[model samples]
Target chain A: MPADLTRRKLIWGGLGAAAAAYAGALGYPVYRYLADPAEEAAELAKVTEMELPEEELPAAGSATILQFGARKAILIRHDDDTMVCFSAVCTHLGCTVAYQADQDRIYCACHGGVYDPRTGQNVSGPPPRPLEEFNVERLDGKVVIRRA
Target chain B: MWRGSMAKSSSAGLSALGARVWNWCDERLALSSIWAIAEKKTVPLHRHTFWYFWGGISLLLFIVQAITGVLLLIYYRPGPEAYDSVRSITYDIQFGWFVRSLHSWAANLMVFAVFVHMFSVAFMKAYRRPREFGWWTGLALMGLVLVFGFSGYLLPWDELSYFATAVGLEIPRSLPGVGALIANIVQGGPEVSTVTVQRFFALHVFVLPLVFMGILGVHLALIMKHGSAVPPSEEARPERERRSIPFFPNFATQDLVMWLICFNVLCVMAFVFPWQLGKPADPLASAPEGIHPEWYFMSQFQVLKVLGEWIPGYLGEILGIGLFTLGGVLWGLLPLYDNTSQSGVRARHATWLALIALIGLLALTIWGYAGL
Candidate 1:
């Protein structure tokens, strides 16, 4: 009986060890495959500053969305000629928020998220957080937006 | 006399050779035992016997889908060429439109049939005792079927499919923490680009089929092990009064006849109303009006939409998903909770739960369409 018990225990131990090894062997490859290579490169490309020419800026009282290091940023020039830049992605579900010139606010059509264009604050609807604001600089013939 | 004797001897010799070959295989494989098991298997005949046919109907449609899908794959290409390839199939290739239409129609019909089969099983209280695994496996299969439909929907790369898939991905993207990561992996990036098409194509054609086939094998094996569950009503009858037909030639024959009818219906739908290919998707273009998902997904879509409007600060969408998940868990675990009160009687609370769920699904689906 003692010998039989030892044999069974050895068998079970071997099986458990084999199972763990097998899981690690399979899981690592899957993890690597699901980790997007492009995402890593995008991370590496993130810089503190992006320069846009004044000619490239949209007409005053309107807005334009641009790519900033794998993320979307919106640039708006109010009627009074003050320039503001904020992340275009809604805090609610990552849907792109659009500047509504008529309402003088940013609106996310996905879930009706509303934000204050001037301050980039969550005003109403399902947005849980305020949009990330960026500092805008006016140089000679250049409009530079710097990440905050 | 000589010619007659020679012909008779030759025929006898052929029979003896055939019998020897059969015996050789039987000794190694025990084929006769399998035949015996089939001969002994039986299906109970009752008023609810008709409900039993829906499972077979779904299986038949799945088979049709497999064949038509393979036919489409012969000409279909994924990625940037996806839209063009499908366009060529629909407009240029011989009988390609029919194959695509059949696959689409079969997918829809199979989903409907599975739903009916599941509800019938629930109402009939077929998910009791030893057959609990059958119910669970069936639910898993249904979930796989939905995934199959969703993934396949995006393969065509048309305007409707692209935008609908984009909207559908919102459900997962709305999730907290790993939501962005999951969405990135699923869509192959931050957006539903050509890469998304390739990923979905792989999922639809290869990954999903492999998993689906494995689960389906288990489900069928379980059905064979337990036979068909006689409804509670049928079970209440005296054993002497109960009637059952052998599965081999009897129940199988009925199943085949139902499949034939289903095939005819599929053919008519595929031929009469061919599936349409819309304009190619433009990522920058605004979503067209009345954009909604497939009918199977309409309920959840409507729930999210209504709740998103009513609640504030992401709480409403969260609540909507939470409630839906809770309901699904309860439904999937029905066999575990509703196992008691056996002996050929319907469980009252379980029935009521199922009825409410059914009514809610129907109402929500209708509301989704109406609002659209």
Candidate 2:
């Protein structure tokens, strides 16, 4: 090949090779970065259970907040010895709901959203859906809250 | 004789198959003509040729933003969960931190690249005559990109973004007639709430991207139609003295090299200085001290602050907003104001004006950072 043609080939070839190498180096991490997080699958199978002594439970008609991993749950005890728990995050906007003993409903201060404590149903507010209910079991003198 | 005949028959069969494929494609599309045009394309080489890469850099950053933004969307939840979800993505999700950081860093760099591209084009006076529409589209893209930055800033739902957005939304209220209306639309109500966040999220993810893609298509088409503008100085030279290079392999290779360098820089920045979440937003709390908008908005923010101090009340805000709007209008109509034919003494006034504006912005940015 002529000198000029050979020089052009070398320059173009080098650029092409360098570009490919750079892309490969950067693209691998980018592909991994864009992939679905492994935690999503792990979370699908995650089940968390926390037990509190029966004495720690709030009195009848009252409720207390429980920490579950990075989430919060409100535990309400009834006069009939039945206990109920619901995720504290309001369905409308995810604000932490507080149990109002006098009104006997869970209330979100952010937007006047209300949910029935017993059923976790949207009572009368901007909330579009009921608060999420958690499984509660009373065993061995303790209340166990199971979250999936 | 039989073996030779069989070989000839198979070769003819292969040729027939290729012809059929070509005919099938040709029936639906005219790829040959497109290729011919592409082969004929050339980019002028001159002293200011390096500046041309900024447009490509901006486009690359935008692609990065789009990809990373989509990745972030998978884990991001709007509304009150936004803050925690962002935190979870940063801390819990695997490689989420890297993706989120890359997205944020690329967004900032994209804005920077766009500004540089705009300024470079302005100085080159490339917006003359037939390129006026191109200039308008470019200006529109700049506005869209700023909107992109503003909307994306609020997605993290962190303290800085939250307060900054609140202030940003307030600026529209300074418009004379429909000011409050615009602000209301942006906020989705009288106050910034879940609705505001949702509205911003929609604008950032769906609405803006579609609009940007449309405008970008037009912009690229216009660039190809008119080819790259030769700097006025180069245009002034005799035809024999002006040199050119083919777009393929030559200019394209150089563009690829610059892109690689930019990619490396982005990676280093994303990894070295991962974007911080700041503090989670507290709606009930007052705006914190030293709270300001993103760096791109710093100059305007500083102007508002100084104006507020000097003039007092809504008057100052109105004046500041009015001035900013006027500047934007003038910038969008730059081609109309500058009718110069080429660069040199003739272009000095426009060039000096651009320089002064740049210096003024830099000074304001520094002053804003100094909290004065």
TM-score of chain A of each: 0.83, 0.71
lDDT per residue, candidate 1, A1-148, as tens digits? 5656787798998988976986675355334433434545567557779999989999999999988877899999999999999999999989999999999899999999999999999999999999999999999999999997
True contacts kept of 1: 0.00
Candidate 2 chain A weakest ten by summed lDDT: A36-45
Expressed as tens digits, the lDDT of each residue in B1-372 for candidate 1 is 656665889887677778999999999999999999999999998877899999899899888888778778877899999999999878766566777888899999999999999999998888988999999999999999999999999999999999988988877888899887999999999999999999999999999999999999999999989988887777778899999888889989899889878887887898899999999999999999888899999999999999988895578888998999999999998888788646423377788889999999999999999999
The Cα RMSD of model 2 versus the native structure comes to: 11.3
- Residues A49-88, candidate 2: write the lDDT tens digits: 8899978999987889987655788998877768899999
Q: List all candidate RMSDs to the true structure.
A: 24.3, 11.3
Compared with the true structure, what per-residue lDDT tens digits does model 2 show for residues B171-290? 988777998999998888987776778889999999999999999999999999999888778888999999889998799989988987897799899899998898888788898877
Which TM-score value belongs to model 1? 0.69
Tell me how far the alpha carbon of residue B364 in candidate 2 is from the true structure, in angstroms, after superposition: 1.4
DockQ of each: 0.01, 0.25
Best by TM-score: 2
The TM-scores of all predictions, comma-separated, are 0.69, 0.74
